[model samples]
Target: MMRVKNFAHSTFATTNHQTMADAQALLQKADKKAASGGGGGFSRFFGGGTTNYEDAAELYIQAANAFKLQRMSKEAGQSFEKAAAMQLKTDEKDDAPNTLVEAYKVYRKTDPEDAARVMESAIQMYTAKGNFRRAATNKSDLAGLYELELSDIPKALEAYDVAGEWFSGDQAEALANKAWLKVGELAALQEDYARAIARFEDVARSSVSNNLTRYSVKEYFFKAGLCHIASGDLVATKRAFDTYLNLDPGFMSTREFELLQDIVTAIESADQELFTEKVFGYDQLSKLDKWKTTLLLKIKNGIEDEPDLT
Candidate 1:
């Protein structure tokens, strides 16, 4: 066993050393090519200088892949960035953003801040080229990085909102709604009920006119109602619920609507057990996601903590 372990370790070390060496060699070659392409006074005057930016960019990309093989993420990211810059200097402007996206992917595993910065660069390039769909996709990715890695909820919300608008402009309504849903969820998390409600309602209203998204309107209205409940405004919740029922008479038949109604009754009577029972019943049929469970718990707790006014 010890002999086998030692052999494995030796092989791993040898592979890593070779990979690093290869990356360094490629990087040096790329640097030399880039320097040669930088037309100096004499080279420019003599007209003998021909930019090797394309070759340098290819070498940089190879170096980046080699660095990745050695788990050197930061080095890989830097190499990819160099490749992107080289590509930008050449006529391959389209490929430059893709190279930067590679850098963003590399940085994402270890350095979220760097990842966000690189992704923003790619997004800007994409937008500048009128590739709004790709820009929207990257913006959604940026929003995830901000929310999950950086814990910057506000930035995440903003990014999602922008992504939704871009997707809508591109006639990608389904994708737009997906991004808007993230904005709604994040807003709700921030306790910005008005913002959350508006987003959910807007999506629900839009979805009601489309056959593909019609079924989802109930869930959106349910979420909006929950947000209203969380806001401690029962009147608004009831009014919104009435509007939802009128907008889609079918919503009244869904278990989501029933749960909303039960929750409202529970809150009105300060019946914590009824609230828990209703949620548990619905959950048994269709498991509640973490977000929904959290909101329900908040509502239940609020009912329990209500002060007597009699």
Candidate 2:
């Protein structure tokens, strides 16, 4: 809690609104003094009775939080940005980047556009400082905002690709794989199976080469095979499985591999009903929800073009 300053034996406003008003007044006075390049009274009231950019930044942050208590997100975000700028100006390098991220989060709660702008600012700051890891992380967040908040798939994919590049440059292979996985998902959402499979294949290979989680490699290959099958490329599906076994030879005996083999056999026999029945009867496959069943049906639809009662 901020203690009310006693001036001339008059207690400063103790109410939240009054306190906020006083803080803003101080902020404005400081701004005026800052504009004229003259240290002002606001500086004297800050911690240690010394007015400086760093102290002004803290004051702005306090005012911003007071505004936030009243549900004023935009003002709060603006105040945080000011704090970040002042932190940078004071050569407080370590805290500057994350302060901007804090502002971006506040903006994201009420204004996605402003959130993206703030993130871009943070990215630029991080990049200029050669902090590629943080830049890549922020780029990934920006990509998510584009996808989920802005509903712009192309921009989201572009953002992910750029983030992946930065992560790769930073030798953060796991993070790079995550970005590429998202890119692959977006490609699949767009029904660009070839592109999706290609990205999935790339990530899967990288995961194996980097010796990341072993199970994920099989999952990636399975997803790629699904895409190949959905796109009516049985030969590609066979090759995908072959590649998977070669990479993790032990996976060849897993139920997932058996399921793949059964699926391939069903496709080769051109027996859509048999494929559906075999898939539904498999105990492990029963775990697959309806959407996946629908995708498998799409692959079955490719196997045979016919209109008849099941």
Flag regions of model 2 displaced more than 4 Å: 1-16, 38-56, 85-96, 209-212, 265-270, 282-286, 289-310
Angstrom error of the Cα, residue 189, model 2: value is 1.5
lDDT for model 2, on a 0 to 1 scale? 0.76
Candidate 1 residue 197 C-alpha distance from true site, Å: 1.2
**Deviation in Å, model 1, residue 240 alpha carbon:** 0.9
lDDT of each: 0.91, 0.76
Q: In model 1, where do residues sit more than 4 Å from their true spots?
A: 1-12, 40-50
Estimate, for each residue in 1-310, the C-alpha lDDT of model 2 and write its tens digit: 1334454235433465676686577567545433433244665445223236666677667767776766677887888887776776564766777877888888886888888888898898899989999999999999999999999899899899889989999998889989988888787767788888888888888877654467688777766777777777777788878888888787787766777788888777777877877677764544875545656767777768744434
RMSD of 1: 2.4
Best candidate (score: lDDT): 1
